[model samples]
Target: MRAAIHDERGVAAIEFGIMIPILSLMVVSVTDIGLAVFRKMQVEDAAQAGAQYAIIHGFDASGISSAVTSATNSTAVTASPGPVKFYGCPTGTGVSVVSAGTVCTGGAQAGTYATVSAQATYYTLINYQIIAVAYTYNAQSTTRLQ
Candidate 1:
């Protein structure tokens, strides 16, 4: 008769089988979170960029749109909510900007401040080829560059 010693050969396969699922979940979760953060930052940058362009250019909606378009360089951006009409400012009080026309019309002064909200819709790619789950993301940022 012979003797049996500790080999631990099959133990590795068992451990790996247990760890794969956990590892995959962690990786996908991280990916989802990272993508969300990235999308949020992108929208914020676009909004603030549009606002800056508006304050400097003044009453030019297309220019602001172009600025954000240049910032995002994507078709997902919608600049229609602005230039956001300004209704109360240059009177030592803050400006109240609304949406109706292509630019601020009535309540804005020469040095009045304005703000605009930018939105970006993100479609996450999750498939059996990529990961085996589904996800979607929508990010928004209200940038005050004025």
Candidate 2:
């Protein structure tokens, strides 16, 4: 009975078994986080690409949206149009543009401002099954059109 109690033959195996689940959980969590970060960066890059295209293309809604989609190259993310606000101030601090080429106040010109933005639906991998939580990721870029 004493020998049996003192026997530690299977101790390593028991420890390993206990640690396996924990290690696996950590790895999965890290993977999920990495994926989320990658998706976010991709979305931002896509938005910037669309904005750059718009600056040269007169801010065509369809074209901008297409550019964003193409940049992302992911079916999981959907690109949508964002608001186009104009500003007389270079910093866009005062006044808003009401029309395509007009500003609500100040000396801001209509063709002086343009913006491109993209929004995407983000799904969490870990809690997707337990609770359906969806997040929206939005990115925007603004430029002055000559």
Candidate 3:
């Protein structure tokens, strides 16, 4: 009876069996998070690509949208809210919209700017009580054309 109690045989197997589920769950969770982050980056890159297209090719709504969608391998990405053109003065952080003829506080005249946006939906492999299974990611880029 004492020998049976002290027996260490199969202990490693028992421990491994107990930890398998936990390790598997961790790996899956990490994979899901990594995929979500990568998709978000793709969305952001798509927006930037659209803006670049606008800067080089000028702002054609359909053209910008096409550029955004084609910028990424994922078909789920799209140009959402469409592209917009406005007059704005360049600021330290970003462009500040103003009248076409208006001069900015820094003495610079307002210039034409275009904004492009991209969006995508990400679905997780598993749903958790603390977080939703699906997430929406959006990104936007603005560039001065003139």
Candidate 4:
């Protein structure tokens, strides 16, 4: 009687098939996480830029935003990318400020100075999902003022 042997080709194919999907998934996950971090930074920087603009120029929130946009990615800040918005000034003080921009309005007699806040959103290709679903990521930013 001669010794019998079985083919290993099928086993190799099976292993390869299983590993390909897992490897692909791992690559995709890494890419997604990196993108998320990048976008979050963008939002924060944009907000800071907006506030900085107000601080130096006085009013004209748009001007600061424009500076930020020019410095960074404008598309990341806004879907349409219009002028930076300013709103809600204190009743007196005569310093132009926006209410929404102001974080805590009443620190020094209602118009002494205002704290400013700004926000920006970033988009990513990865859509987070749970149990077969999808989601969108939202990024935000804020700044402080006198």
Candidate 5:
């Protein structure tokens, strides 16, 4: 009836019902975002660990990847293939770095550096691939060799 439409009774209930889904979505989004950030930090730490390992023990692809995998301690993340890269550069002055190609062992100079990268894919809670809701995440670290 027109009087029922004009009346404000039960409006709060209707509003609450409408807001509930939006609030729930917000909560889920926040939770997912927090988890994504945590995962990103873990990946970054893994990359840093791998880079440090390479710096100390020289570049061993398997060892570096193992370090990454161990650091994360999660099966959801997979270390990228050929994650280690070596750069040779002049030390103690203006420097130019050149890629050591595929081979890295015994190729680094005093000022040379090693870079390690880690990557993983996180499946999103919502299925929205067009918005990049789920995609590959990458982390990288570089350390100068001693």
Candidate 6:
């Protein structure tokens, strides 16, 4: 009985067996998070691509939408809310929209601007108790056309 209690045989195996599940969980969690981050970047890039298209070719709703959708490899990405065209003046915070041909407070002329938005739904491989199974990612980009 004393020898049996003192036996170290199979201890490494037992430890490995206990650690296997933990290590697997950690690896899978990391992979899931990495994928989520990658998808978010794709969404952001899609929005930026749409804005760039509008800046280069002017704001065409259909063309901007197409650019957003085609900018990423993921088919889940979409151009949400389409594209918007407005006249705005550059401000300290951001673009301040006003009437066309309106002069800004700083004596700058209002410029035509386009905004593009992209959205995607990310579904996790595994659900966690604290985290949701599905997450929505949205991105927007704005650029001056003139």
lDDT preference between candidates 2 and 5, better one: 5
Question: lDDT tens digits, residues 28-127, model 5?
Answer: 8888888888888888888888988887888788988888888877876656854645466654653356655433335744355667888877766885
Stretches > 4 Å off in candidate 6: none
Clashing pairs in 3: none
lDDT of 3 by residue, 31-127 (tens): 9999999999999999999999999999899999999999999999999979999999887889888888998887878899999999999999988
Per-residue accuracy of model 4 over 1-146 as CA lDDT, tens digit each: 23335545578789999999899878987886687677667655665665566666765655755755654554655322333343434446544554543444555432333233334544444454642233233333323343
Q: How many backbone overlaps does candidate 6 show? A: 0
Determine which window of 10 residues in candidate 4 has minimal summed lDDT.
131-140
RMSD each, Å: 6.5, 3.3, 1.3, 6.8, 5.3, 1.1
Q: Model 1's lDDT to the true fold?
A: 0.60
Write one digit per residue (lDDT tens) for candidate 1, span 34-140: 87677767777887788777766775667877777678766666554665534432324444454433244454433334555566666554453664443333333
Best by TM-score: 6
lDDT of every predicted structure (CA atoms): 0.60, 0.70, 0.95, 0.51, 0.74, 0.94
Worst 10 residues of 2 by lDDT: 87-96
Which wins on TM-score, candidate 2 or candidate 6? 6
Deviation in angstroms for 19 in model 1?
1.0
Off by over 4 Å in 1: 1-7, 90-113, 125-146
TM-score of each: 0.64, 0.78, 0.94, 0.57, 0.73, 0.95
lDDT of 3: 0.95
lDDT rank, highest first?
3, 6, 5, 2, 1, 4
Candidate 2 collision pairs: 88-108, 101-110
Cα deviation of 107, candidate 6, in Å: 2.3
Reference-based lDDT, residue 145, model 5: 67
Backbone clashes for every candidate come to 1, 2, 0, 7, 0, 0
Over 4 Å off, model 5: 1-8, 85-87, 90-96, 99-112, 128-130
